[model samples]
Target: MRPGGSRLECCATDLRPRPPPPPSSSPQDPAIPSGPSLPPAPALRDLAGRLRRLPPSCGPVRLIGVDGHAGSGKSTFAGRLARALGGAPVLHLDDIASHEELFGWTGRLLAQVVEPLGRGETAHYRPYDWRTRRFGPPRALPPAPVILVEGVGAGRRALRPWLAALLWLELPAEQAWARGRDRDGEEQRAFWDGWVPAERRHFRDDPSRPHADLLVRPGHSVHEGYDVLPGPAGTAGQGPDSHRT
Candidate 1:
């Protein structure tokens, strides 16, 4: 809630690796544990191709929100998909959230990002400055053809109506928490203690997977499989009301 309280102005990756090689196209086989999946270049391109074709679900943009427990590999998966989409823009919840607000930052998001995007305009948001423990200057996000919103609550009800699709990082809560804690290291252990239940309450009340168009479980490698989740609200899935082509 820095200075940009709400009024919206306008608008608006990388490649890493795999725990093992990407699974066969079917992706149903257990992930081979021998090594990580280093996806072949062609497979990466295919992801880009398919994502490019998803019907535009947001006003004029195909906005896909990736939601899951923190450290559930949501950031990594979103980065890969963004690259596949030829550098599609990814908005991380970390940028919008602060230690103070945590899950309470939704109103700022709607004011700064969703409202403008709904009108097919670019939007701006003040990313939280973690080190300073406060928000910094405003950053602008253009309304691209495909905008990937990645974070824990990217698929919350307040924002779902404006999204084209919701994807759940299907890893279990404990596992995700472990990964997140490991990633942050001992430095952030205290912060994580409080974060765990805050996340639980957030999901318990406004879960997003029930409305996910895809449930993504990252294998030992980077390749991902998407399961079609049934739509929970009018906001998602392959029902008669599904927005997917």
Candidate 2:
């Protein structure tokens, strides 16, 4: 989502709720590198090329999802991927989620963003103001070839049906939560305390990693920042024209 005006809220830990780690082992997508030595740039380029060629999953758009544990670096990864896609529009779930709704904003998402895009039209949704605890004016999101949905629940069951690909940021829960807490600091400590259990409950019931087509692990290399591994879904290696329900 565009980051102009008062839309900037204390988004530090909203999506960074911590949950227990899910299972690790799964069938692999042979297209991804198995070793730790794989260069990150080429992998991301390959992913971008593959995604660009994929058939649109929602209307005229190839809606890609970047979902993982809070503070797992979904936003940063999504921004880089968007750049790789030549400035594809990114819809941050933070704009759709509110203090009252949180994960309960699915209906609003469908009505405001998904449905319009599915109908080959521009979408407009009121971004929530976290500080004021109110929603602002409607912001327009045009239908781009590859639009990214980035946040904690970007790959929820309700949205998978409309995604060209779902990518999970591979990071353990405790580690990710620690990173989130450290980033947010004491100011958000109370919020994180409540968010942890809520996030746990959400993930325990509706997990995203299991359904992901690609698993992205943060790379230690400063230049090449991420390694895109095969996810449990095993569909990552398929041709761009392939489909997944």
Candidate 3:
């Protein structure tokens, strides 16, 4: 199942055409209010510590997933969470996805990353270069004690089975998408034009919210820290208990 192997031919055929992008519309406020105030930094740190102690779901790695809309601060949050976990490795889905195969990376991820890590070996996969529209050289990922998979669909059904915990950023789609578009700027507008719709369709078909172990919302304080609440999928009993302020 390794990359550059026979599996790739079948994987390529599994790629589906991108759906038409959704119609443009004004951004709307989230229907639900941001969850209760976040616990203090000490509590968050405690949660991270506990996660670091969890039994590895993949080989010797406790694979955590940070999933949310494109602009829902997933990368920033994952970075902070990684630091809290004492420098866990992070795998960005952006590197696995290409312009032509937005959500068609499950096979590649499994073959190049997950399977190897599951076997207690270092995983190497070619990262896609969006600017060049071609995959670059292979990147090495060590099978650390804790690893984070962050991106829009990190919690998809295909990946959940391998994750120790799935944390969903509780931001509304419209607002998140707006933030993403704004962050990328006018130059990437056309790309966003197509991305918006594809994202919408992907979520519609395989929503991740209901499967999240924790619903993470920004903190009410000036620093805008973050709050982690119990989600429909329920906590895995390894992190801090759900706290509401």
Model 1 lDDT, residue 40, Cα: 25
Cα RMSD for candidate 2? 11.7
lDDT of 1 by residue, 16-96 (tens): 322321211100112222223543245446545555566666657777887888866676667666766777898888778
lDDT computed for candidate 1 = 0.64
Residue pairs with clashing backbones, model 2: 16-70
Q: Cα miss at 134, model 3 (Å)?
A: 1.1
Worst 10 contiguous positions by lDDT, candidate 2 = 5-14
lDDT of 2 by residue, 138-245 (tens): 999999999999888898888888887788888888877887777666666776787778788889888999977777776443333555555677432433332111
Once all C-alphas are superposed, what RMSD does model 1 give against the true structure?
Answer: 10.1
Q: Choose 1 or 2, whichever is better by lDDT.
A: 2
Q: Estimate each model's TM-score.
A: 0.74, 0.79, 0.79
Clash tally, candidates in order = 16, 1, 1
The alpha-carbon deviation from the true structure for residue 12 of candidate 3, after best TM-score superposition, in angstroms, is: 41
* Model 3: per-residue Cα lDDT over 203-223, one tens digit each: 999889897767777543325
Candidate 3's displacement at residue 220, Å, is 7.5
Clash pairs of candidate 3? 22-197
